[model samples]
Target: MKKLYSNTLMQLIIALCTFSFVACQEYSIDSQPEGPLNIQIDAQDSYTALATSPSNVVFNISSNTPWTIESDAQWCVPTPSMSASSSLVSEIVVTMENNTGKQSRTAKLTIKAEGISNTKVVTITQASKEDLVVIPYDELVATEGEDITFTIASNKPWEIIPSTAFISNIDKKSGTGNEDAFEETITIKVPANAGARREGTITVKTEFMTYTFTITQNGVVIEQEEDPESTTISVGGTSTGGTVKIRANKEWKVEVPKEYQSWLKAEALSDTELKITTTVNNQLSTRVGHIILKTKEVVDGFEGITFDINQSPAFWFNGSSENRVIDEATGDVKIMAVAGNNVIANYAIKKGHLTFELADINLNGESCLHFNLWPNAGNANIKLWLRSNSDCDFRCAGGFGWGQKMFSLTTEELNAIRTIEFFVEDDPDNIGKLRVRLSINGEEIGNLVNQTNIYETDPSNNPGQVINLQFEGGLNYTEGDYYTVKSITYEPAE
Candidate 1:
């Protein structure tokens, strides 16, 4: 029985040992690195590709397992391209491409061994590439110094973190299109400062891209200085007139005529070559305004003129041959010219008197009277008479006759209230000497003067009103030889 038991135990033990060995072999086979294909690979962390050079990719394949790399995987270009080496552990090189004017990108790579695979893609960017990114104006044409508002319309699709930039404090806003342009503003000051030129740029970026713009500043340039001072002038004096020299700025416009305009000449040495000067040579009844000097768009030449007032002649004798006439301080008028402000004065006081022996004296109604005066301190004594022809008769018309009427001569001041009269009427029966009374308030001033032959032009026919003195000189003669004037002299009344 013991021997039989020993034989069975041995058989069991052997069978158990064989079973343990098979189990051990099966566990080892199950723990082994198993796959469709398994081979150790030398793939780096982010293999696949880089910006420029090829990224080496090694794939581990199982023994006798077939595998290949995708054709579209390149490391140096934008589009992916690839090439693979032997089985067991296939290796591939990838070249990536540069995208926009932005970053560089590499295609995702996958290694397949017997239908199972894994993939990894990488993108590399270029060195912040940027060109003349035009900064567009909102309005092509605009006014100076207006506000400009905008932002960077970037190139990429995704919203990007703006790149570092510099400009005249531009408020960045929303971008434009897919290839959106950067936004900014430039203000132009006008006239004086605006139209001047200025310069600058625009910049933008994402995780990958950067850009910039060529900046320039531009606007209109205006003037404001035209206020001028007014010219003042005084009457009874002189004034310099013409284009008032506008030292500060702006534009202007002068005429003086005859009267006191004697020797109407401006001094040659005067600095006011563009100005005009005139003098008042005589007196006038009305107030004369300023002496205006007319201006023109261009120069014509010198304009010279003069005027006359009532019969107060304005005589200028600078080079004249008169010894007694003296020049006034005003440098224009002459004193003691011809006895009556106009001629050569007769100073000797001659004794010879003129007598009129008229024939016939007729007036065509015009009474031209002549007078002799005695002036003493603004007071004057006067005698007047009708002038007649040489031959005493009753017919010719060549004479200044004033015998028909009578009037008074009185000064408003000194000679006022003095009554002087000569009473002598035409005699109907005589042709010889006629007696006339020349008296001043019951006193005889002188001999009652008479004329030879002179006719009277009715006072109603005369145009000029004469200041005649009723006080006659000597006695009135008869109508025969007509009343004759013995003399016209400056002798005092006796």
Candidate 2:
């Protein structure tokens, strides 16, 4: 019984000790925690305001420890009760004084916690309202001869003065004595820009500041004339021709058409004067041709000149120094004229074979002598163009017209005074068709057939219809280039 009592008491004691050990272990586990103190702020890092307006900052904080809010900026003030109690939520308020200065400013607020060594910052920005600014900003652009307006905004009275004489028409030069308000519309005008691009500035003077507004104006361009002046001349029938004068402001050149090249030429006496000479028309009636003169440089009122020439019968052309003669035996023609004055031929057509020789063949860029036979009405035409130092060709003007023998007359042949001949005869196979045969220095070329019309019985090739014989020097008209017509003859073809 003693052993049983002792064993039971010992078991009770062991149970009490196990209970105490378990309680001690539970107490030790409850004494320590895993989570740390958490702090949070609900507020933006920055704030903005106008210079004349005051601003406020508010912060909502959730913290597990005591915290205090303060401001380092002199312009920033915080409430006296700015601390957050431990384990509680609090709202902090800070005030920013009105920014009346002339520039932008910034302020900062700091939030500090008892347990946390770290801090949070909030920034406040303010703008100044004491500036003078113009609408549409600091620059203004306008075209030549344009008008513009501007408005000034300032807190004090201001004056606007233009920096350039080109700017004019100021409606108002000074402000209306109002403060902190935009001024009335100030109008200004720009004159015609006959010069280059221009830029200037207008100074806006205020009590405390100055504003500059730039003005940029476009430039103007002078226009060129399109049509040139013109004149006319009439030639007589005698073998001797007359002279006509051309006037200009500068060095000028003449372009003669091919049809009149048989008897007409031009001479540039001075920079301003051009003398034209014609060969007395040996044919029975009147003929016509053209001359175009152009200046090398642009002149204010002078661009170009056109001449209308009318030549009379051979006997009527007497009294002029230029002369030509036809040999009755072999039907050859000889012509003479001043060097550059009259180098082309002008004649009325007769029923005969025609022969001519090239005294010289000198050409520059795009320069040539033109030859064509057609009624002045400008139809059923044929063309033969001779380019100096280059090639020659023959082609009918209208469609169905034939072209042949490109470069048939070489420079050597032309410079050697080669004779070019043409004959019109009735086509035996085709009735009403005239066959025109061409040759250079006696060498036969193309034999073309003309089916359009026959020569009229009237003294003129076509009565009431003017025929043009042109010999030009330039690509368009005539430049300072010429080809000499050494001699020309016509013989009645049997």
Candidate 3:
């Protein structure tokens, strides 16, 4: 009985040991350690940047898990707050705003990763506003042999470097900056330039940054002599005028006749030139005038130089008369009734088509046709047609206060006397083609037609074909809804 009890006790001890080992193995399988929480940051502990301008700080992060970033200051912001786990290194950017504060400031940035107990810290410091340099002007314009003064403010030492030889005698080449916003006055002398305008640059260097500015200098003027006999100036009937060369060494005075003084004017443009001007000469005959130029000294065997100015006459259809009879057969222009029973009258209101043939006028070159008309009441619809030698016809038809392809007029302008002009010339782009334009009251409106093939079909046969201008009143014209043609004029091509 004693041997059997000893064997039973040994078996019970072995079964208890086996059960404890199996329970330990099951606990180890259920609660295994998590993957390694490895993370690294590649950046410095501190950084410095400018205060006046925005600056950026870049760094790299390496991690097996996701990461995030945060900033303590409102001015300092990080681009990405959270990032996924990446095998390759990821870049992070921290942008700092411009610091307008009087003193320098600092910000703290924290970088953290998932499942990590500790975070990386970075400190960023920005300079103060007083630490930056300031330039008031970026460019300077100086005359020949002139001095230019400018100011520079900074709290550091600065230097100026001129890029060209013309810049000389700088008052201050170097200055020590001050903390009280001291402005340093810099004066530079520009030497005389006898030939042409010159340009150069002045580079300013400070402890914080570098800046560049431009310097422009004017050229000198030289005296010249011009012969007055060979210098002849002519102007159109209605033009501002032209210039004439004069001797620069003499003091000159111009004398205009009493009759021509109201229309002619003369002034000195420069020491070597004189500008002559004239008002509009609305007469039919060309006018001639002599401008007597009296100088301080005698020149070319005469006490006073005489310059003859000839102004071309303005073309008129009825010899400058507002009310004139229109001959149906012979004259500079022939008038004929075409559409309605209304006849052409002297300053008369008409409601029919009137064809005016430009007798013996050629349009192969540049020319202008001008006329005055009054739209009696605003209910008249007028059509003006221009035919060049029966080849092509250009038409402009519109009521008053409306826009047309040729021109546009206001209601007030149509009720009063308004001048209408048509200009015909060769097309600049298309060779052998013609271009026509329209104008109202001396202001050019727009082109009527361009690249028009005129006089091309029978150029040899129609060598001197006349231009036909026709006016047609609206078919719905009433008693008072009629337009009147006051005057007609033509300027032949020169």
- Measured against the true structure, the TM-scores of the candidates, in listed sequence, are 0.25, 0.29, 0.33
Q: What's the lDDT of the predicted structure labeled candidate 3?
A: 0.55
Candidate 2 RMSD to the correct structure:
20.1
What lDDT would each prediction earn against the true structure?
A: 0.31, 0.58, 0.55
**Of the candidates numbered 2 and 3, which has the greater lDDT value?**
2
Highest TM-score against the true fold, candidate: 3
RMSD of each: 33.0, 20.1, 20.2
Tell me how far candidate 1 lies from the true structure as C-alpha RMSD in angstroms.
Answer: 33.0
How many residue pairs clash in all the candidates, one count each?
65, 39, 0
For candidate 3, the C-alpha RMSD (Å) to the true structure equals 20.2
**Error of model 1, residue 9, in angstroms:** 42
Model 1, range 1-494, lDDT digits (tens) per residue? 99999999999999977865674364332112233444333444444233333344333232234444454434333222221332322234444343334343434444454444544333333322322233444342232344544344444432222222223444433343243334333332212112223344444544445555444433221111232223332223222232222221112132344443552432222222234343432321112333433332222232321111122222222223442222232222222212122121122111122111221222211122233322212221234443222111111011222222343332221112233344333333445322233443455434432322222332233221112212122433322221111111222121
Off by over 4 Å in 3: 1-41, 50-74, 77-95, 102-104, 108-121, 127-147, 154-165, 168-181, 192-494
**Model 1 Cα shift for residue 467 (angstroms):** 78
- Top-down lDDT ranking: 2, 3, 1
Give per-residue lDDT, candidate 1, residue 28. Answer: 32
In angstroms, the error of model 1 at 441 is: 95
Cα lDDT tens digits for candidate 3, 377-455: 3322333432222222224322222324543333343334245566555667757655555654566655544433323
